[model samples]
Structures are given as C-alpha cells and as structure tokens.
Target chain A: MNPSLKLAWVVLLALELSFTQVWTVNVVLIVICLALMIWRRVAIKRLLWLTGVPLFFASALVWSLTLQGSASHHFLIVIFTRMFVYVYLGGLFTQTTDPLTLTRSLEQNAHLPAKFAYGFLAAFNLMPKIKAEVASIKAAALMRGQVLHVWSPQLYFKAILTAMHWSDQLSLAMVSHGFVEGAPRTHAAVIPLRHRDWWLTGGSLVLIQVGLFIGLP
Target chain B: MKAWHLRDIILVTILAIFMGVIFFVIGPVYTILSAALAPAGLQPLANEILLGIWVMAGPLAGFIIRIPGAATLGELLGAVVEMFLGGVWGASTLISGVVQGFGSELGFILTGYKRYNWLTLVISALTTTIVTFTWSLFKEGYASYHLGFLAMLFTVRFISVFLFGGVLTKLITNLLSRAHVVKNVR
Candidate 1:
C-alpha cells in the first residue's frame, strides 16, 4: 500500500472516531500527516502552498479578533489549531495517494458509479497539466508585456479562456479513447485493505472516541 | 451508463470523493476552524462576516456548473465534507451550508440561470449575506451584539464576498476557460 493511502485511512478513521465532535484532534492528525510527507521527500514548495491555505483563514480570524472584543479568544484558538492540521492532512493525502488507487478503492468499497469516477479521475490526472498550461500562458503574456495581476479583471478573463480550452481538449481526448459512458472496462489493480491499514484505521478511531468522551461534560 | 463497468465506476467514484474532499472539506473546514479559535468577542463579528463571504461559493459553483441544483449540491457537498472531516460547529455547519446555498441559488434562479454578469454576482453576494446573517442571529444570539457591530459584520461580509467569491472565483474560472477545461458551459 502507498504510504499516503495509509495516512488517508488513518485520518479517515480519526474523523470517524471523533463522531463529528471537537475538531482539534483532526487538526493535529493533519500536522502529523504533513510531517510524514516531508519525511517522504515531497517538495517543500508544494507543502507550503497547502499550508498557506489555512494561513489565509487564520489571518481572517486574527482580523476578526482585533475588531471584536476578545471574549471568545480561547475558542478561536482551538478552532484555528484544528483547521491548520486538517488542511495539511488533506494536502498530504492528495500529494501521496495515486489517483488510480483512490478511484479503485472508492469503486470497490464505496460503490460509486464507474462513469462519474473515471471522468473525475481523468480530470484529476489533468490538473498538473492544466497548471503547467496556466503558467505557460502567464509567461507568454508576460513576454508580450501583459501584467498578470490577480486583482485585474483582464487576468480573470484570460484564465477562463485558458481553462475552457483545456477542458475541450481533455473531453475530446477521452471520447476518442472509448471512454464513453457505459463502456465495459477491466480494473488495472485492486485496492485491498491490508492488516496495517485496518490497524491504523482502528487505532485512530479508538483514540479519537476516547478523547472526545473524556472531554465531554 | 451501461450496467456500470467496474473500472470506470471505481475511477469516477474516487474522483468525486477526491474533489469532494478538496473543495468541501479542506476549504470550509479550514476557514471555520480558524474563525472559531480567534479571541472571543473580538472575532465573532468578523468571523461571521467572513463566513458570509465563504458562503458565496454556492453562487460561484452555480455559475461554473450552470446546472440545476449545482449551487445547492456543491455547497451541501462542501458542508458534508467539512462535517465529516471534523468541523468546529459540528452538525450546525450542515444547517448553515443549506441556507447559504439556498441564498446563493436564489440569485441564480432569479437571473434565469443564464446571466453571469456583475449584477447577478452582486445579488448573489447580498443574498448569501442576508441568509447567513439570519442563521447567525439564531445560532450566535444576535441579541448579544450591538447594532453598530451587526452593521459592521454585514459590511465586512459584503466586501469579503465581492472580493473572494466574486473576484477570485471569476479569475479561476477564466483561467480554466482559457485552458479549455470549462468550454461551452458558460
């Protein structure tokens, strides 16, 4: 099993254990996942982008705190901690888990429709390529002395144009490759739940449930 | 499609789950958790205001998907993702998600779901603001805050929505369009 897939199952178990209570534990789990990703040699820049999302929210909370009186400051702190952890966990999971494995697991275990799943899988696979295209577009624009300011409406319009182009090509490619709805296909690999995966999932669940019970009034 | 090819079924399911996890769980949960932890009274108004802004995601989704129930489904999916991942508000997050999506969808519906103009975006922002604020009144006890505080919350929320959901989402969709990822959907 891929290490990232292992991490995702662990996080999912932790989430299920919490039974929809106290987000702090989930946040901690996210941080642990991020550490593991770094250990596994993922690029620092990508990690930074993932972590940066939570930071943006944190800044909003900070701004809110300054404006309002600090009555719920303690509550806010706890929330921020959880948010940061969970976001990183999500980032790590995506970075490490292969989309192919993820798709297979969802189909076999969760009973999702193949047509929708495959379409999305294709879309996910295309994300990196789409990103590269965006970069090239920006670079080309820059060469023509176009300022790529995010705040500008022109930049926004240009981005939409680029996305539409990519989607069209991708859709056409899929159709040409016999990826039509209802087509018969064989699985490339099976996503089995190993002993390690089960143990990790169970352990995370037990720990979370115990913590929540202890914390509750 | 046809009795469901195992490979295709699995692939699509995973993709949906992944997208669900990324958009619904990661984004909103992060925002909600951060808002919940800020220093007490100091953050409530601003946090609520920010929540209003985040809620505009529904209308933005509608604009992109342009399908019936797209806004509602997208927002609800996002909320469910957040809840499953452990949001601070617990079940209450789901309630907010429904109301916010409804509010945004109303704007789209009023525009006949055809126009993606600035007016429609502004209406979407206002609709989200009003609906989300109404929910906060019940959940957060709006009676606790002064009139001035409430006004500030509304203003900040409007500005946030205009900038983030309206401006940022537009920018993202535009990029997607140029790449030909969202063709003929507008």
Candidate 2:
C-alpha cells in the first residue's frame, strides 16, 4: 500500500477514535488494530509495553473509574481508547513506511514542495545523528568533570546548538549539490491509486460511520 | 542567508524534528509527573504545567528565525514529525500543534515581529496555556470540574508556562545567541 494511503487511514481512524465513547465500538476498533499488529508479526511484548506503560501511569484513572465513578468516566475511557488506537495505527504505518517512500508519496500524491519534502526527509534522517550528538555532548561534559543534569536548561541549550550546527552544515552540503528551493524534481517511484487503496479508505469510512451511529446513543 | 532561505528550511526542519523528539521524551516525564500527583488529585494540573515546556519550540523558532510564521511552522512541523514517529495521540497531535503554534504566533504578531524580548516570550507562553486550557474544557471535559479546581489548574499552568516555556526557552535562546548559533540563522 502507498504510505500516503496508510497515512490517510491512520488519520481517519485517529479522528474516529477521538470522540468514540461507546465501549463496544472502541473494543471493536482496538481489536481490529491488535489483529493487524499480530498479522504483521509485531511482538506481543512490544504491544504489552506500549499499553502497559501508559496504563501504569494512569492507574489513578482506573481507580476513579472503579471507585469514584462519575458521568465523565465515559469520557475518560473514550480518550484512552483514542490514545491506544492511535499508537497502534501510527506504529504500524511508521514501521512499514520508509522515509524515502514517504517523501516520494507525499511529493507525487500530496503535492508537497520538493525542496521542503526532501528537506524534512533529511531532517528525519538526522534524528539518529542528533541523538548521537547529544550523547557526545554529555560525554564531553562528563570528561570535563561537569555533572550534566539531563533536565537542566544548559543541556537543552547545548543539544539544540549542536543540532543547529549540523543543520547548517547539511544545508550547505545540500546546496552545493544543486538543491534549489523552488526547483522541479523527479520521482523514482510511481505511487498508483489502486483498488486496495479504495477498499481500505472506503471500508474505514463505513466502519467510522457505523461506530459513530452506535456510539452516539 | 536571506529570509526564507534554504538555511531557514534546514533550521526549521531540524528544530521541528528535535522538538518532535523532545515531545516524545516528555511523554514519559509527563506520565511520571502526573502519576506522582494522581494521589493528590492534581494529575490534570501536572500535565498542563509540564506542557508549558512544549511551547518552547514555537518561541525559540520565532526568536532565531525572526520571520513571520516561524513559530507556527515550527510547531506544526513538530506535530507532523511526531505523528510520523508514532506519537500516541495521532491526529489530535496535529490539532494541538496548530492551536499551540497559533498561540505563540499571536505573540510574535502582536509585537509586529519587532521585539524578541522576554515580554514577547511570556506572552507566547501565556497564549499557549490559555488556548490549551480552553481546549481541555471541551476535549477533556474540564468544564465538569469544580470552579475552584479549574482556577487552580489555570494558575498552576500559567506559572508553568511562565517558567519552563517562557523563561527556560528565553534562556536557551540567549545562550544560543551568545554561542554564535543564532548568527547562522539570524
């Protein structure tokens, strides 16, 4: 499937899950996501960790729902459901879609600016490097016998400056290679709008409509 | 570099992506903070207070880029990048980005983009906190809470934005300026 289509699906499901308060519809939606994860061979342990951490933090929410129940308890459930479903869908889409494919799909299909799209993809690529820069900054701070507090403003300031340096360097390199902001570009992959795309989109719409119809009561 | 140059795009993208990562990192911090306060029935306020820090991305972008829409682009790009990185809130993340970005954008706009001072930073932070609180009133059902509780939430959140988002971001921006990092973009 085109990453854009998957992105659309994720966007739709997330919006649908947002206000869906009915337990039955929520369960159905979550179940569908869980099934997809299993089909994709995503580790059950991964899913457990994803769900467990949030639930652990929100233990008070569970306590309130069970003990100090109120009308807004339903709202709580709906919001949590929205959170979990979004995580699952987002995880699925991101895991399957590479940055190149995403940029290509976005440029061809979504009409995003080439320079901007590629610029973003380059930034995404730099994420791992940014993490490394942060680590080296910490290491250097430690070498100097300065106890680098992770939560301290100094650490953030240093990290951002390092990232900015890298960004400036990379921008120059990209420019040297003939990248123009408003210039035209070509795509390697032709993203076709196929039957499955329609099936996924149309099916999601129908399910969301049904969910809303049942959830409103 | 001229205004809106390739360098500007690079700075915005990198900052946005960095903010996206920061947003992810803060998730755990927020969870822990809120959980700690859950026993005291201050969980709602905990998230809001910490949320002040999230506003830093917008103002910091505006401060360095010194361009119209820098704050909003920083915020919106961060949201989109976060969603791409599997943010749990999904599309609502985009909504929050737009709202929060607009709040800071209003701050820069009100000053005619002339002043990049502390007052403008505080205004940016306050605007973000107010909009998020109002958004919570409907989206998170804060309207159902007692008036006293809501007021407390607002107060704590205001202090939080003032400190973390406003003061801390301003400090960091100043540090960058001193380090010559700001010159690359400015």
Candidate 3:
C-alpha cells in the first residue's frame, strides 16, 4: 500500500467518522479498527492506551452533548466510535512507517517541492536526538550552577539555541554535498502503487457510505 | 537569505520535534484533566486549554523565523511529529494542525509580519482558537446547543488559547531573543 494513499484513506474515514450519527455505522468502523489491531498483532495493553486517549477525551464531551436529550446521547456514542477508529488508523500508520521514508514518498508520489521535502526529512532525522541534546545541555547548565526549571522560558531558549547551532552546521554540510536550491532532483527508486491499495480505498469509501445510510436518521 | 531559508527549515524542524515531545508529556495530563472536568461539563473547555499549548509552536515559529507562512508550516510539522510519536488524535491531528496553524498565522499575516508584539501574538492564538472551535462546532454538531452553552464554549476556548498559545509563546520567544539565539533568524 502506498503510504500517502493510506494517509488519505485514514483522513477520509475520519471525516466520515466525525459526521456519522448512525450507531450501526459506528460499530462497523470500530470493528474494522479492532480487526486491524488484532491482525497487526498489536499488544492488548498498547491498544488500550492508544484507544484510551481519545475515549477519555470524548467522554468529557458527553456531559455537554447529552445535556438536553437522547439525541445528544446517541451523538456522543457515534463520536466515541469515530475516535476509536481514527486513533487506530493513526497509530497503525505512525507505528509502521518511517518518517524519512514518508518524506521521500511525499517527494516522489505527491511531487512535494524538493527543498521542502528534503528539508523536512533532514529535520525528521534530528527528532530522535532532541532528547539527548536537551539532557546534555541541561547537564552543562547544572554544572555551571545555572538552575533550569521545566516550565521556565530559559529551558526552551537553551534548547532552541543548541538546536539552531546544529542546524547551521547541517545546512552547510547539505550545501557542500551539492544540494542546490531550485534545482530538479531525481528519485533513485520509485515504487509502484499496487492495485490492492486502490481496492482498499474504494472499498472503504463504500463502507463509509453504507454506514452513513444505516446510522443517520 | 530568502524568506524560507534552509536555516528556517531546520529551526521549524527543531521546534516541531521539541513540541512533539511536549505533547507526549501532556497527553496523559490532558486525559486526566478532561476526565476530571467532564463532571462539570468543562471537559470540552479542558480540551481547548490543552490544545492551546499545542498551537503555540505556530506563533513561536512565526515570531522566531519571521517569515511568510512560518507559523503554519511550524504547526504542520509539529503535528507530523506528534503523529510520528503515536499521538492519540491520529489523522485528525493533521487536519487540526492545518486549521490551527493557518488560523494562528492570520495574526502575523495581518501585521505584515512586522510586529511580533504582545497584542499580535495574543490575537494570533485567539484566532486559532476561534477557527478550530468554529470547525469543531460544525463538525461535532455543537450547533445543537443553546446560545448560553455555545457562548461558554467560545469564552473558554479563547481564554485557554490566549494564555497558553498566545502569551506563553511570546514569553518564550522573548526569552530567546534576549539570549541572542535568534539574532540571525530575522
């Protein structure tokens, strides 16, 4: 499956999911999400946390939504079902895909501008290291008798300064490697989007329509 | 350098990654806060407050980079980072990011990207809250509510975004400016 297409499908279903008022439609979508989770062999504990976040948040809206009558109650349920399904799809995507690969896929598949695409990818490469960098910076500050509080503005300022220094060196390296601005770049590999991906996309749309039909009054 | 320089990209990325980690930390707190507030029917308000913090990166990026569309790009990239870290909102986060980012970016655009002052930042954050809340009312069907209830939602959402996303963002940026780290940025 093309990653971008998968993103489109998830986003589309989520749009449908939000407006879906029919209980049966909501149930069907939830079931599909659960099936995906099981098939992917995601641990039950992790699945609980993944789905739990949205569920907890949605529960808060129930009081406000259900204030008047059973209509609001029904709406609340539909919203819960949507959140579960949406979280599952999002979790699955992020869990399975690599960020750098995602940027590359965007560049080739979506024709995202090269400067923006590679620039984002370069940033993605730096994401995992931010924590270590912050820690080291904090340690140095501590050694120098500079107290840093988590909520303090100084903490973030320090972090950005450190990151900016790294970015300066990085941009120079990128330029040195002959990455020119406004220049066309070619992909060494462009994978084909399979027929199955299209089938899934179409099938999901149909399912969503059927859900709306059954679920809405 | 042009408006969207390589350094700006790197800065946005760094800010995005940093904010993503912050969201991860806040996720559980948000859940707990929402649940605690649900009984008072302020859960929605709590949700808005939590979102205010998330939206800050846009204005922060915009103020620091002082470029066209910097806020929107920063917010979008931050959303991507959140999704990467398995944020609970899923695909919805991307939509929220775009809407909220563009919404916040409006304040900067209105100022001709010349004023990164307190008032502009506050307006930027409030604009984000207004934009996102309006969309939520439409999408979540809050139109079913009474006028009083609707007003309450609007007020809470504004305050939350104003304090956290708007004011806090300016505070952090000001600190950065004082430290002279962003000297080369603008």
Expressed as tens digits, the lDDT of each residue in B35-134 for candidate 1 is: 5655454545446445643464476567666665667655764564454443333334545567778878877888887777666777877777787777
Task: State TM-scores per candidate.
Answer: 0.57, 0.85, 0.88
lDDT of 1 at B10: 30
Docking class of 3: medium
lDDT of 2 at A83: 55
* lDDT for predicted candidate 1 compared with the true structure: 0.57
Clashing residue pairs in candidate 2, if any? none
Query: Which regions of candidate 3 deviate over 4 angstroms?
Result: A67-71, A139-150, A210-217, B1-3, B179-186
Error of 1 at A173 (Å): 2.0
DockQ of 2: 0.43
Please say which candidate is ahead in lDDT: 2 or 3. 3
Error of 2 at A64 (Å): 5.4
Lowest lDDT 10-residue stretch of candidate 3 chain B: B177-186
Q: Write one digit per residue (lDDT tens) for candidate 3, span A105-205.
A: 77777777787877787777877688777677668889999876545576677777776787788888898999987788877877467798889888878
Q: After superposition, how far is residue A187 of candidate 2 from its true place, in Å?
A: 1.3
Q: Scoring each candidate complex against the real one, what DockQ results?
A: 0.16, 0.43, 0.55
Q: Of 2 and 3, which scores higher on TM-score?
A: 3
